[model samples]
Target chain A: MEYVIHLAILICIYLILAQAFNLNFGIGYQFNLAHVASYSIGAYTTALLSTELEQGFIVCIIASTLLSALFAVLLGGIATRLKADYFAIGTLAFSFVVSALLINWKSLTRGVLGITGIPRPIIFGRELNENLDFLILIFAFVLLVQVFLYFIFRSPYARSLKAQAEFEHAAMSLAKNAGLVRNLSFLIASGLAGLAGSFFAYYINYIDPSSFSLTEMIFVLTIIVVGKPGSFWGVIAGTVFLVLLPEPLRFIDIPPSILGHMRQLLYALILFSVVWFNKANLFPVQRGV
Target chain B: MSLDILPQLLINSLIAGSIYALASSGLALTYGLLKILNFAHGHLMMVGVYMFFMFNDWFGYEVIGSAIGCIAVIAFIAYLSLKIFVLPFTRYSYVLSFVTTLALSTIFEAWISMQFGVNVKSLTTGFQVHSIEFMGIFITPIQIIIILSSIALLGCLAFFIHYTPYGRRLRAFSQNEYAAQGIGVSKTNTSYVVFIVGALLAAYAGVMVGYETNMQPTMGNAYTIKAFAAMVLGGLGNVWGTVAGSYLLGLVENLSIGLDFWGYSIPAGYKDAFAFMIILFVLLLRPQGLFNSKSRAA
Candidate 1:
């Protein structure tokens, strides 16, 4: 039961991540690799605030989400001014910079040692320490985020954003500020990533630089692309498929070292095959006006 | 630092820069012709180095011969992979090709790790002397070879691109593939040839690097980033600019290392930070890069 709850919690975390990524890639058509960096910033912020300042869980989560959103604003300002590919490159550089800071800012981040012993959430005079309770909290948060995202996806704002993605000049002619829409989408997406990061830190009870590498970013990207971005259900389905698909490999009689490698292999193969087969419809090319 | 130390550092930087130039030029070529970022380019080099090592160990082939043979084998495999898997999807979205190549990179890395454990292996055939003196300054022979080979390769590549019929066709195709096809250029054949040539150049760099340093599967990550940096710095599709960018990057890195303010020595890990900082600054200041003046911003 504990294992099942743990898996459930992880699914909720990944759902948040995938949906946030979908917002940028699917709605804004921006391929930002720095999403993981924003996620890391949130994790570290919560870790530091709770461990150092003795802040409560709720305050730390809010602070983490805000900090991530602030960083996203800075990145979005630069990214929205450039071409799509340049945005990707710029975000990749931002990720490296964040990773470097996380590794080198030993006085603050404790370098590679990471932070530990983060306490679980406490709500209304009740401590949600048990796996079942924690699972409920996570699922509620995920459902809330999903509903919020669904509303945003259905709104006229989302329509305009999608319009900007399809043709920025056309959208502009229609009295839409495409750059502003992109910036808003990116900020929201990164804020959600931060929220997910806080939950991840609280659940894992440990946060490290290794947990937020380019490899992790690529995995999230794989999920977004595999699930066929732009649809809320598509992202949810993608999260479920990716998280659950690698579970059965645990029972295989392979060396532990090779087991980890096999998972990566399978992910790579699936990502490759999906992209190849769904090249046209999946991630339709957005023309710039 | 003394003058002698500065010269030595310069030589080392040149050698490192040369490797970046060689690998990045190939990447630029493919990007120019295909408009697809070949994420597997670094892995092509990784596989090539492993093949070179295997040929030397198993067949007892001479060092230079095995290097050439490794390049041929890698180029052939890459060509076949492109023909069989990539060519059929030429008309497809660029992102599909990008994802496919990235997956191929992961697959190659995994297969190599599966075949040979993640232990770093050193090549024994290259020059490994500590240092050699030249004009009151000390440098390694390998450094000299690196600089000379880079210059020679750049000159040859320029001539090939400018003077040959195939090269003119490639240039035309790079400009507009559809138009080139209308003019009777076979896009399939052109793409295959360009990819193979690019792979060969990457293989050559891999073998040379193996000779200079220890070979490992994870080295591809660093090389991949450096190549991308060089490509961006020089501007995509410009070979001369890439070569120039590599040397510029190398020099800046060496100068940073030589910088000692108030007797505090910056660790070598800061090299990546410095390179990336420069890349970010360049992106902000001049997105078109140093060589390409036309802004590609949409």
Candidate 2:
């Protein structure tokens, strides 16, 4: 039962992260590879605040989410001005900068020793230390985020994002304010990723630099691509499926050393095949005249 | 910190820049021709170095023979990747190819780690290290060979792109795809040639790096970013610009290591961040890159 609840909590966390990614890559056609960086910023923010300042859950979550969104302003401020192909490269470079800071800023980040004993959230003057309580709290947040995402997906703003993604000039001629929409979407997505990161820290009780590498970005990408990018329900289904797909590996007698890499290899292959076979359907080209 | 180390620093810069040039040229070519950012380019080099290790260090083969075998193996892998992961999406979204190649990189890293136990491995060859002193500067024979090899390979790339018919076809294809097809350039054939050549250059760079430093599965991660930095510093698709950018980067990095201004020096841990800084600054100030003035912004 504990294992099941743990998996449920993980699924909830990834669902929010994937939805955040879905907004940028799936809806806006902006492949911001630094989504994991935002996630890391959130996790690190919560980790530092809770451990150092002894801040409560509300303060940590709010601070983490806002800080991550602030980072998006910096990332999106530069990324929004670049061409499509260059946007990915710029975001990737920004992520590397964040990673470098996380590693080299030894005084602040503890330099890879990683913060431990991160206390779980204390809600309603009660400590929610059990896995079940955390799962329930996380699942509620997931529901709240899903509702927010659903409204955004249904709004006219999302239509503009889709329009701009399909053809920028055409959307611009339609008076869609593509820049505003792009920045808003990026900010929101990163904020949600930050929120998820806070939950991750609270649940795991430890946060490290290794948890948020480019490979983690690839895993989120795999979830969205497999679930069919731009589809709201598909992302949810993907989060559930991918989170559970590797569970059976634990039942096998494989060594722990190779097991982690085996899962990565599996996801990489899955992502490659999905993108390869769905080339025509996914992100259809919009040739300019 | 004195003038005595200037020559040494310059020599070191040249050596580092040569390896970066080898890595980024192939990256520049694919992005130039097909608009495909081969994220796995450095990982391909990683695999090549491992293959070199398997043949030379493990099986006691000669260096030349092992390099040939490495090239052959990487060439095949590059071709297969292009055929399967890259080419089909050239006409489609560029982002798709980018993600696909990113996945390919993950696959390579994971497989290498799984096969070779995540431990750093160095190549063992029979050759002895010998450094020659000229004008108070010392350079090893391997370093000289690496520099010469870079010059020769880059020269050959220039000649091939400028003087060869196939190169003309590639240029034509990149310039205007429909017009090139109308003029009888086969996209499949051109991409095959481009990818194979780029992979070969990367293989050589990987071998050079492995010979110079230790080998690890994630070693390619830094090179991938460095190559991207070089590519962006030189316009993204401009081959010659990438080479110049690589050398500039090498010089700047080495010079920064030697000289400290304002009583501050870059820490060892932050060395990798230098590439990101260059990239971020370049992308912000001049997205078209320094050498290529033509704007590609949409």
Candidate 3:
């Protein structure tokens, strides 16, 4: 029962992450690899304040979201100077900067030891200390965020974003500000990613540098890419498929040491094969006029 | 701050520069030709180190023979990776290229972590701890090996790119897309060659670095970023520029590692922050490159 509830909470957490990525990369065509930086910001903020300062969950989550958005705006401002592929590299550099701080700032971040013993949230003077209660809280937030995203992504603003994504010049010729739209998308995506990060910290009761690595960012990237970009339903389906993909392997007789590697190997193979087989549709080339 | 420290810093700087030079040169070639950031290049380097370890450490093969075997394995992996991960999506969208490389990176890193665990591993070079003194300067065997081999390899690369027909084709490909194709440069085959050569250089450096310091799965990310910074410092398209940039990075890094500031010394762990600041300065001041001109094709 506990396992099932835990899985549900995890799915909700990752659902938010995947959607956030979809909004930026899929819709805005902005490749911000520092999404994980925002994630770490949220996790570290929540973990530190709740453990050290005894702050409640609501304050921490709100603080995490706002701070991550602030970071994204700053990163986006500098990154806007770059072209398409260079923007990805720029964000990756920013991500490295964040991770470097997390590793080297021992006095503040505790370095690699990570922060533990995170406290459960007490809302409305009620102590919601159970896993089931956490699951309920996480699901409510996911549902609320999803609805908000659904409406925004389907609006005309998203069309302008797509215009900026596919051809910034054409959009700019029509008086649309590509830079502003990109920054807005970045803020929204990173802010939501931060919320998911806070929920993750609350659920696990711990936060570490390892959790916000390139691998974790790739996992979220894989979810949205494999799910089909720019489609909310596709991302939702992808999240469910991926989060549950490893569940059935518990009954297999593989060695404990190699099992994790094998799963990753399989995931890589699948991702490779899927892209290869569907190359015609996934990547339509633009021939010269 | 003192004359004694100058000799040690120069030696350390050269050693560090050699590794970065190897990596940055590879990055310069690929970025110049393909114009895509191969994010998995670092992970591919990790695979090479592990392959060397499997041969020399686990199977007890001779060190020289193991290095050859490791290069062969990495070349084969590089070939397959290009066909599967790069060729399909590179023409379509930048995001696809980034995603594919990232996916492959995750696979490589995960496999390394699962197989090796979190414990650090060091390559046993079987060298003495005592430094050899020459002309009042001390140098270790590993440092000597690093400097000599890198020079030989880089010299060979320079000769190949400047003289050989295949190298000419690579240069043609780098200068302009349509012009290269117009001049009968085979895009697919040349790209495969580019990927293999780039990865080979990075792997060679990675194996040496693994011998020098601790080897872990996550080491790839830091090296990749540093190599990129070096690539920018030297120039994007020119290989020799990468050489200069790598040494520049090495010198600046070691110089800043424990610098004295008005009778106070800085911490070594802040070296990465220092490296990042150098990157920022390069990007802001000389975004084209410090060593090479902007219009360079190779």
The candidate maximizing DockQ is 2
Ranking by lDDT: 2, 3, 1
Interface RMSD list for the candidates? 2.0, 1.1, 3.4
**Model 1: per-residue Cα lDDT over A163-249, one tens digit each:** 988778899999998889999999999999999999999888899898998667767878988888798888798888899898888
Q: For residues B1-298, could you state the per-residue lDDT of candidate 2 as single tens digits? A: 3567888989999999999999999999888788778889989889889988988977778988887888888888998988888877777888888898999999999999998889998875466887899998999888898999999999999998999987998888768888999977888888899989998899889888888778899988889999999999998888999999999889888887676657776776877788898999999998889998785643
Candidate 3 Cα lDDT to native: 0.82
Task: Flag regions of model 2 displaced more than 4 Å.
Answer: A287-289, B1-4, B130-138, B296-298
Candidate No. with top lDDT:
2
Model 3 residue runs over 4 Å out of place are A283-289, B1-4, B114-118, B127-129, B134-137, B291-298
Candidate 2 TM-score to native: 0.97
Model 2 C-alpha lDDT per residue in residues A212-275, reported as the tens digit of each score: 9999999999999999999999999999999999999999999999999999999999998898
After superposition on all C-alphas, the RMSD of every candidate to the true structure, in Å, is 2.4, 1.6, 2.5
lDDT measured at residue A129 in model 3 versus the true structure, 0 to 100: 81
TM-score of each model, in listed order = 0.93, 0.97, 0.94
Global lDDT of each model?
Answer: 0.81, 0.90, 0.82
